[model samples]
Target: MKVTIERTALAKALGHVQSVVERRNTIPILSNVLLQADGGALILTATDLDIEISEEAPADVAGKGATTVSALTLFEIVKRLPDGAQVRLELSSEEGRLQVSSGRSQFALAVLPEDDFPSLSTDDLETRFSMPTSDLRRLLGKARFAMSQEETRYYLNGVYLHAHTDDDAPALRAAATDGHRLARIDAPLPDGASAMPGVIVPRKAIAELGRLLEDAEENVEIAVSSAKIRFGFGAGYLTSKLIDGSFPDYERVIPKGNANVLRVETKDFAQAVDRVSTVSADRTRSVKLALESDRLRLAVNNPEAGSALEELSVDYGGDPLEIGFNARYLLDVAQQIDGETGTFKLADPSSPTVILDEEDERALYVLMPLRV
Candidate 1:
């Protein structure tokens, strides 16, 4: 395969596809990227047998052929080339080498047979819909932080994406939890998504999708099936295998009828929690929140280090309550609140509490309390 591409354009495409290739692979071809040159563009595909990413970029094609080369090696060569340089890639079938040249720099890389590269099957998707990229990015950002990292409970290792009805209106919801904290966010359901099935998008795919949508402003097309999910935008597409296990009924975990309520500025609440947490060790960092009529005090105690206490004025009129929570969890939830004020609904020290943005009803957090 022979193709001429601009350094900047090729580097950007390689950056996206190479992330899917693992650094170490038992199968030789899995660490390489498949390059196909056609009429006017070059297609790059990389996969780890689970998640696959394919991207295309405009290139000057001198020969229509396909080959595979080490993704890391090729990317490094292109990245080091001078800016605005035109890069030429040619495959030497007799020598079994891929030659990359830009200006006076040149490198010969080993090539693998393209026939050995595995391609994921494209089955008929059960549901296909399109939504603004901004909306999708926001949905994932709100809930991804709570996704579980443990592999044993594979069902909880991803964000649960589904369609639902909230307040008599159709909505698209994203939720995640790690047994200690939960996050739920909703957006207006896009057209043609009523029949979409709930799917657990794996953590790796969620992270990749987030990177893809970083500067996107257009709409993103999504296709979902029982076994897989695909996200398409611009000249790139990503396909991922969904978790086969069933997610727990998360709605049942949300607390109801929490009589105690407290409202405070989000910035103030987050800063206090951050300051008090420094007194405790990293592994067992817990902060105690003491609430009274209109005051809230944050305190942390560590036998090895020291103790810290800070007070903040709040809006609370219910009975006094004291609760212990992980300081990191509190900061994460507070940072996500879009409004200036953060609202907390509490029942008791042992029960889970609900937190919400004073202005946004579609987003909330559920946190499990720890024993102080």
Candidate 2:
């Protein structure tokens, strides 16, 4: 394979795909990127058997061929090369190496047979849908903080994306929970998304895809099957294996009959909990919250460290209630609230409390109270 490409464009395309490739691999070919320069563009493909990333960039094709070269080494080489310098890539079958030349710098990287690289199949997807990159990003940001790190409950380790049709209209919902706190965000279902199947995206896939979504705000194409999911936009495609286990019936966990509702400035409540929690010891930082009329007080008491008491005015109509919640949990939920007011609905101090962005009804959060 031989091609000449602008150094920055090559680096950007290769850099995105190389992130999915691990530094060390049991199969050597998995660390290399498959380059195809036959057509009008240079196609770079990399995978680790579970996730496959492919990106295409415009290039000057000197010859029509394909080969595999170390993805990391190529990325590092392009990164160190002078900006705006053009790069030339040529593969030599006899030498079993790929030559990378840019301006005054030149390097020879070892190559592997492209056939040795594992190919992740996409035949398992059952449904496909499309949404703007901005909407996908909003859903991910709202829910990712609640994803569980514990592997035993593998379903909770990724975001749960499924169809949601409420009284207003059908919608797509993204939800994540770690048993203690849960984040559920719903957006208007795009045309033709009603038939999409529910799936739990794995943690690694979400992490990598989130990085791409940071810069993609126009449109994102999504396809899902039984075992794999693919996201496409522009000239980049990310294919990842979905978690096979069944996600818990999350709807049943959400509380319905909470009568007491209190509204406060989201930032103010977040800051208060953050400041008071600092006085707590490393292990336990439970904050007791007392709500009465329109006044809310947050306090943390520990024998070793003194206690902290902070108060904030809020909107409340029901009788006074005291609840004990993990300070960190409160802070996380508060941060997720998009509006200025933090609306917290409660059944009592012990029952699960629900928080919402009062200005928007589409997103709701449930936080299980922690015993103080």
Candidate 3:
């Protein structure tokens, strides 16, 4: 392949697909990106067996050809080249090398046959839908923090997306949990989304897909089948294999009849949790929250370290209740609440507590109490 492209455009396209290439791979071709140049455009494709990303950029195509080269190395090379310089890439089939030259710098990179690269198919998608990029970003961003890192319960390692109804209106929901804490967010269902099937998007796919949605105004087209999912947007497409496991019944985990209620500023609660956690040890980083008629006190006690206590005025109507929770968990949930006040529904000290953003009714969090 022989193509000439602007340095910045090439780097941006490489940045989109190179990260999906695994550095440590048993197969040499898996670490390389497939480059195809034809008709004044250059297409870059990369994959790690499970997820694949492809991006296209405008180029001056001297010849129509395709080859493979190391993704990270090419990314680094293009990144270091002088800005606005025109870069030329040419493949020497006899030498099995790719020639990269920009201004005074030149380098030869080893090339692999494009036929060796694996291809992910999207033949039979059961459903297809389109939604605003900003809405999709919010759904994934709010629930990703609660996704499980432990692989033992592999089913809990992704966010569950399904069609749901909110306030008698069709809505799309994304939920995730690690047994200890859970997060759920909902967005208004877009046109042609009523028939979308439920799918569990793995943690890796969630992160990569999020990076692709930087432009809020752009629309994302999503296609899903029983075993795979595909996201197509401007100048590119992302394909990922589904987890092939069943997610747990997340609706049952959310508490239903929590009576006690407490309302406090989200910022105040997050900061108080951060302050008290300083005195907590690594193993048991627990903070106790004592709620009374109109006062809330957050305290953390560690025998080896010191103790921290902070008080905040809140609106609490139920009887006094004392609860223990992981300081980190509290902070994670509080940071997601964008409104002025955060509302908490409590059943008791031992039962799971539910938190809701007063201004954002579409999102809710459930945190299990820690035994202090």
The better-scoring model by TM-score among 1 and 2 is 1
For each candidate, the alpha-carbon lDDT, in order, equals 0.92, 0.87, 0.91
Q: How large is the C-alpha RMSD of every model relative to the true structure? A: 1.2, 1.6, 1.2
Candidate 3 lDDT tens digits, 1-372: 899999998998899899898889989999999999999899999999999999899999999999999999999999999889999999998888999999999999999899998999888987988998888899999999999999998888899988886459678999999999999899999887777778899999998988877732388888988789898877898899988888888889899999999999989889889988999988868999999999999999898998999999999989899999999999999989989999999998999999999999999999999988
Clashing pairs in 1: none
Please list the residue runs of candidate 2 whose C-alpha ends up more than 4 Å from where it truly belongs after superposition.
124-126
Error of 1 at 295 (Å): 1.0
TM-score of each: 0.97, 0.95, 0.98
What tens digits encode model 1's per-residue C-alpha lDDT throughout 157-205? 9999999965697889999999999999998999998789999999999
* C-alpha lDDT of candidate 2 relative to the true structure: 0.87
lDDT of 2 by residue, 199-305 (tens): 89888888988888875649999887767889997888899988888888888889999999898888888988899999886775699999899999998998888
What's the C-alpha lDDT at position 131 in model 2? 90
Q: Pick by lDDT: which candidate is best? A: 1
Query: Where does model 1 exceed 4 Å of error?
Result: none
Sort by lDDT, top down from the best: 1, 3, 2
Residue ranges of candidate 3 with Cα displaced over 4 Å? 165-167, 215-217
